[model samples]
Target: MKQRTKARSVALQVLYECDLTQHTPGQALEQRLAEEHLEPELAEFSRQIVFGVYPIVDKLDRYIAQHAPEWPLDQISVIDRNILRIALWEFAVAGCTPVKVAINEAIELAKTFGSDSTPRFVNGVLGSLANRLDEIRQQFQREKAQEEGLSPRTT
Candidate 1:
């Protein structure tokens, strides 16, 4: 496995623990990395993803909720939700990992750690999410403009 993918899976396991334990994701990640046998770069990358994503769970949840409203956050499997969190963090926020890589990695993770139905469901959600990515991105841009009260320019 690629170092980042390994790190991300570790990070996701931490996220899964957080979901199961109700501890903060950052706290969970810190605890895991402090004790785990990971290289320095891997540790940092894992920390980056966990900390990078921890603060934005609500926003991520809302985005997933919008795209897959039929699957409530609570109803979504833990593995699938964390996969989405990782991919969405990479796609929507981190911008470090490419969207295609994120989706592929997520599908692989789902297959490995998720329920039998999770692979397809993960693929479905991520694929659908990818389809609307530009639209969703535009939605964010528009909202940011509205928040900043910046009017659109017209020549």
Candidate 2:
């Protein structure tokens, strides 16, 4: 695995633990990283991806629900939900990571840690949702433009 992809998986494991135990990412992952004897550079990358998702999680969840509304918020598995959040944050929100890379990385994570069905489920939901991204763009673009005095109408 690529270094960053492995880092992301490590982060996902920490994040999964956080959800299960109700611990903060920093505290939880820091302890785990120390005990696991993980490399320093990879540890930092893992921590960043895990904790970094918190700030934008609410907004990310809203869009995720919009895309996958048939499954209620509570009904969705925490691991699946967090995976989508990480993938979306990197590809859709950050605009720095490529969509293909995010999706591929997520599939690997699911295969490693999620259910036997998880890899396919992860790809299906994320792939379908990611494909319908014009709506996501429209939602964010309009809001952002309005915030910046670029509303799409004549004064």
Candidate 3:
């Protein structure tokens, strides 16, 4: 697997463990990375993803619930939920990864780690979410602006 792909896989595993085991992100990631023995760069990338998703996990969950209302958050599989969170982080939060790349990587992850229907489910939800990414990003920026005591930028 490619570096980021491997990193995302590890990050997903870390997320799964954290959710199921109630372990700290650092603890989950450290344990998983130790077992996997990934390259330094890949490990660092996974670390970034785990840490990035940990803080705003509730926000991400809320966003997912808002977008994929048909699929209640609790009912979704742990693997799929974490996949969406990681992809959403890449798509709307970090904005470092390209949108298509993020969505495609998410689908790939679903195929590997999720159920038979997971890829399509992930694609549909993420596809819809990606369509509204700019709107979401703008809203996020506006919220941040308000918190910083500045008027939000007008488009």
Q: Using lDDT, give the best candidate's number.
A: 3
- RMSD of each predicted structure: 2.8, 3.4, 1.6
Query: Candidate 2: where is the Cα deviation over 4 Å?
Result: 134-155
Cα lDDT of model 2 by residue, 125-148, tens digit: 778768976667566667667878
Q: Give per-model TM-scores.
A: 0.83, 0.78, 0.92
- Candidate 2 — what's its lDDT? 0.77
RMSD of 1: 2.8
Task: Please give, for residues 11-109, the per-residue lDDT of candidate 1 as tens digits.
Answer: 998988987887877778778887777899999888888887776678778888877877888999877898998898787666788788899999888
Task: For residues 31-86, write the lDDT of model 3, one tens digit per residue.
Answer: 99989999898898899899989888887888889888888999999999999999
Error of 3 at 132 (Å): 0.4
What is candidate 3's CA lDDT for residue 7? 91
A best-first ranking of the candidates according to their lDDT comes to 3, 1, 2
User: In model 3, how large is the Cα lDDT of residue 5?
Assistant: 92
For model 1, the stretches where C-alpha displacement exceeds 4 angstroms are 138-155
Best-fitting candidate, measured by TM-score? 3
Q: Report lDDT per candidate.
A: 0.81, 0.77, 0.90
Q: TM-score ranking from best to worst?
A: 3, 1, 2
